[model samples]
Target: MICAPPEKIFRATRNRPALARERARLARAALADCRLCAHDCGVNRLAGETGLCHAGAEARFFSAQVEVSDELELMPTFSVALSGCDLRCDFCITGKESWNARAGLGFDSFQMAERAKLALQNGARTIMVLGGEPTIHLPSALEFVSLLPASAKLIWKTNAHGRTQARELLDGMFDVWLADFKFGNDACAQRLAKVSDYVRVVQENLLWADTHSELIVRHLLMPGHVECCWRPVAAWLAANLPGVKVNLRAGFWPAWHARRHGEFKNSLSVSENQFAFGLATELGLNLIP
Candidate 1:
């Protein structure tokens, strides 16, 4: 028999008290050796120490509440963007304000809480916490979400690297998990994202997601890197995590840091055939493009 869809199962999550308690517990943990995200910097952030992501005890970033309609599966989502990212995807298109952690600003936890409440008041039931990497500033992110009224839904956009430690921050509270499978090869991952162990981290996280929450994996098909980068990862997920939905994106503009980098300077997004043959035919999985 097939496992129920994460959305269907998650809709039944109503243990508000337990979720609240877990959130607080994670908040306290963040003050210690902050293993919030994969970086596991172990710095005493509560003392206002900055980690590699440059996020201190107080979270800093830019945000706007927008109703996401492009993602049909996650349609009508109210999203809050947290600035800063741990990995540097050379082909990133949204690097306008998030490219550099130094560029973002700080907001008090109370003020951030107010912004979340405002989003909810404006009919945003699902709070999509996106960032350079939400896991990097997880404590503040988790605390903010925990303080929200019990009626709000929590969502995240991540690179899926810090599964073992990151799962503790989650504690089965979030309703949705949107992750990116950047490169299939470790060499490519290290060259592109600067993380050599990305494959293992992403795989482990997806395994955890299979048991805990709804996971949607997105892959941007870069022209010269489709088969070598995106294909094997798709194959692995299809075989290991059969039920998770995969979004095969095709439009990868070599903007942002991509243009400056020779590897991506002239790279075109995946074409229709590449999506059909390379990703679709090989994986037999759902295609979002």
Candidate 2:
């Protein structure tokens, strides 16, 4: 028997203009203080002050393109790469430019909406919001999604370091959440991403998101850190988030500042990849290719 597809929550807001407007207002208000991400810089972005993420009052985007090479679940999509990252991971593939809010071309929500509409017209099925870490620009991201064509599903590629306020702003808006759970332990996170409370923040945020959205957890198996990261993450998911889909990625290439760290200077080995996949299988995770 063929099963019916799961409901897309954002469809409920398609015809509700007032709901969109209200959400836009709330997003803007949250941006004023700029406590959207885990950093909690509390910089008054409205007053032209910059925070740790370096984002000003407005949202900045590096690029938007039709990408065919994405997760199988989110293929043939229009991907929007927003600027500014909450965490500074050593092996960031997008490089320093994406993390730096000052570097990208700036655009307001309306402009982004227009661009998204164009992509939809050009045969893009999904609108993927990606970034240095899109959560850093929560307000603009929200506004952009609100403006998207209801026919296109919203896929959020996030670092899962979003604050509670950010979650509140995004509640009931996203169709799928692609959460990147980078580290399983606090020490590894502190060493790689310079975040001390990474474990708690990401876990809490992911658990919260699972309740409201179609959650897909992604873990990029880094070289020499599988025991510290992958195993713990798999264990946690098996115990706490059973039935949640996970993507065990083997594509880890040393890039950007990764060369600076001795352990991160090389790509994942074949053995390491096998071990990661085996661990996932042992844990009974619902893994996606």
Candidate 3:
């Protein structure tokens, strides 16, 4: 089934070309004093000053292809993964590309949108703008939206660590927010991803996204963090956002620098997966594929 009707979102009226351009303009100007993410490095990207993401004024992408690896309803999506990220997750599968700012081809919104159109014509269900974290490249992301067809189903797949300015720029742009709620508490977040106040930031973004667009929360069940991370995440979702689609992702592999951490040296075990699912069910989370 589809995520939701266009009218269900509060910003339906503003998801147009003009609005995209306006948002793009505002995001482009924000490069002078960046506050797009919680890091709030205040670095002038326009002057080549690098922030936590290390991304410059322009955006770069590592991968773009139509894939059937997302949620069932939103499969066959043209996933454009931008390079560089706000958080440095040691277990990131795509760390080779995600952590490097200049790892790929320069982004061309016009060309990429055309490619996405082709994918849509060739059985793709949605156009997904993901990243290392797209919040850092707001201008390019909004520019791509401006070039896309108004009726195209757009998905913003994010880490959900964005701040107020990023949310302001992204208010009504996408049809679905496929966000990650990787950690349930600040301690795990800081220890694993080197990001502080992670729970507060992600919850705030999820709340805003639920109001502005269709939100799908995904939490990758890690090997040793079932209780510390997944339990609290499920409990919060059950309490604050009952019936919200929760993708309890069971695929957690030890990739990248995962060997750096003792717990992340191996993938989740069968017992861990079962335990995580059992907990989600106990909390009454709306688990989807």
Every model: Cα RMSD to truth: 3.2, 2.4, 3.0
- Tens digit per residue, CA lDDT, model 3, 97-161: 88997889999999999999999998898999998999999999999999888888889999999
Number of the top lDDT candidate: 3
Higher-scoring candidate on TM-score, 1 or 2: 2
Q: Mind giving the per-residue lDDT tens digits that candidate 1 earns over 1-289?
A: 9986544356415665356557756766665777666667788877777666666565567765557643575655666666777777766666755656555677455676687687677766576777767776666666666666666667778888764666765756687788888888888887766676788878888778767777788877776776687778778978987756788776667777776566576656437435635656656776653
Q: Order the candidates by TM-score, highest first — what do you get?
A: 3, 2, 1
RMSD of 2: 2.4
Candidate 3 yields a Cα-based lDDT of 0.91
Which candidate do you rate higher for TM-score, 1 or 3?
3
Local distance difference test, each candidate: 0.69, 0.82, 0.91
Q: Model 2: per-residue lDDT, tens digit, 1-289?
A: 9986674343434643345567767877777688988888888888888888888777788878889867787777888898878788878888776668876788577877787788878877888888888877776777776676665688889999988888887776777899998899999898888887999999998899888888889999999989999999999999999878899888898988898889886789889989999999999999986
Candidate 3 segments exceeding 4 Å error? 1-11
Checking candidate 1 for backbone clashes, the offending pairs are 84-132, 85-132
